[model samples]
Target: MELSLHIILEKPTAGVAFGLQKGSGNKYETVQIQQTDSGNLDFYLTVTTKGDRLKDALPRFGGPFIQGPYMGNFIYLDIGTLAGQVSPWNRRLKIPMAGITWEIIDQLSADVALMLKTNVAGTAKDGSPNCATVKPFNGWRVVSK
Candidate 1:
């Protein structure tokens, strides 16, 4: 079965929190996103999973999707099977953004938009990124972290 998961990631410097609320389970704080108190780009990811059973894979999708002090320069999204594992947390299906010019982060927002349409439509198995896009992220080297 193919599953589509919509996930939200609050930008590191954004003065708002976009995550699960109390008793919210995994749903966002609100059904409709609140306008950011600070103007920073927050991530909204449409992740597709390649798997046989969504129930079996659903449990594995939460950890990496949660906000944290990742200390990485770029935002990451997983578009493959949640059950697939390379790292203990399963880091497959990331769109690379290494060496991407962070000089104008807004410019890169188009990449995220395009990805949400095309690449996010599908995914691969065995930890391979699915659905290639044109020069997706211009990575120096992509290692799913």
Candidate 2:
């Protein structure tokens, strides 16, 4: 089964918190977001498996998985370049001077998790029992902070 989640940010600086339930028992995971000192956003992931069913299924489903924003594929845009392209008459173009929004961060996190899960499943199908730690196809864009 494939799952996707979308979280709207309440504010530009506000963090995001969500949970991902796995297996048929009390196994679950938490994904938390926080701002770093360098003006970058970071994620803290924690997985918990308390049932025997979940522990047994860990080999196939791959448990104890954690990830951050830098572990996924994303696109970045340069605010200055974007603003420069706008016509002088159209002064309504307001550029964001702050860091990235939580929406983008949440989407990136979901995308990374999905990719990791899919890769692990595919590897298992190919007769590999271990979870696959595949690198993301690309990295986020470096925007001016």
Candidate 3:
């Protein structure tokens, strides 16, 4: 059997969609997407900083500085019926950031996907957000080159 899944992370605007101004402060810099597994788009979103400025600033900020990109986890559930009763397929996956995890939720001709929400520390509210429909580069196409 062959099964594959695709996941995309999108912002609420066209500019954010293009990664123009996503990071906060001067820490924001260009990052290369490092792939761990291309089959599921598993990768890392990282950024680089110049000089020891970040190092010196850490003391002032009173905390240890962690560089980008932070990884996240993914969880899956399967809702099935047994003996005319509903049952759950308890499944959990530690899907690192830029990773995808999938499992058959049901045997019927139905599609299943999971949506997760992580509370983002708010940045400057400069523009309106595309909260209604936030999508990846191609609506769901997550990988490019």
Candidate 4:
């Protein structure tokens, strides 16, 4: 079953937060980002399947697509295909920015959990950074908190 997922990250900052919202040990300190009234950056991502299920009785079709920064990366989509399926399903997700660079972030799948929660570690090209921790701020679903 090919499906898409909507991933969301909340309350992103630099040198603060953990898990998936950590910034590059302040490396992204100067990175440009839009802030909300409550002081949070939101990222939006959309992923889609590549083919339909019922082909013209041709060979089965469908597969996974991956693209983005390596190591400590964030994925927004997760595409799944059966042994011989045709059509594919899709999901949408919105993530929060942890001061990471746009060039470093990539979208791979569409079914990945709308990780309303995550960390923002620095990019590899930017060099290693100190360990950062992250967690939900209000202990609520990404939509509520």
Q: Which candidate is the best by lDDT?
A: 1
lDDT of 2 by residue, 1-145 (tens): 2212222111222121212222222343223422222222322222321224334322111133422232131211111112133222211111111233344334445554432111111112332211223222222232221
Once fitted onto the true fold, the runs of candidate 2 whose alpha carbons sit more than 4 angstroms away are 1-15, 18-26, 31-38, 44-61, 66-145
In model 4, the Cα lDDT at residue 40 comes to: 41
lDDT, candidate 3, 71-130, per-residue tens: 321211111121112323211112222322122112111432322222211112553322
Please report the TM-score between candidate 2 and the true structure: 0.18
- Candidate 4: residue 66 lDDT (0-100): 22
RMSD of each: 18.0, 19.2, 20.6, 17.4
CA lDDT scores, all candidates in order: 0.28, 0.24, 0.22, 0.26
**What TM-score does each of the candidates earn?**
0.22, 0.18, 0.17, 0.23
Candidate 4 C-alpha error for residue 84, in Å: 44
- lDDT tens digits by residue: candidate 1, 1-145: 1112232222222222222121122542322222234433233433222222333321112233333222232223322122222223322233332232222222323343322212231223443333233234434321121
Tell me the lDDT of candidate 1.
0.28
User: Which ten contiguous residues of candidate 2 have the minimum total lDDT?
Assistant: 88-97
Error of 4 at 110 (Å): 15
- Model 1 regions more than 4 Å off: 1-91, 106-121, 124-145
Q: Which tens-of-lDDT digit does each residue in 1-145 have in candidate 4?
A: 2323223333322323222112232222211223222334333333233322354221121222222233222332111111111223221121222332221122222324432333332212233222222223122123212
In terms of lDDT, model 3 sits at 0.22
Q: How many residue pairs clash in each candidate?
A: 0, 0, 1, 35
Off by over 4 Å in 3: 1-7, 15-27, 32-43, 46-127, 130-145
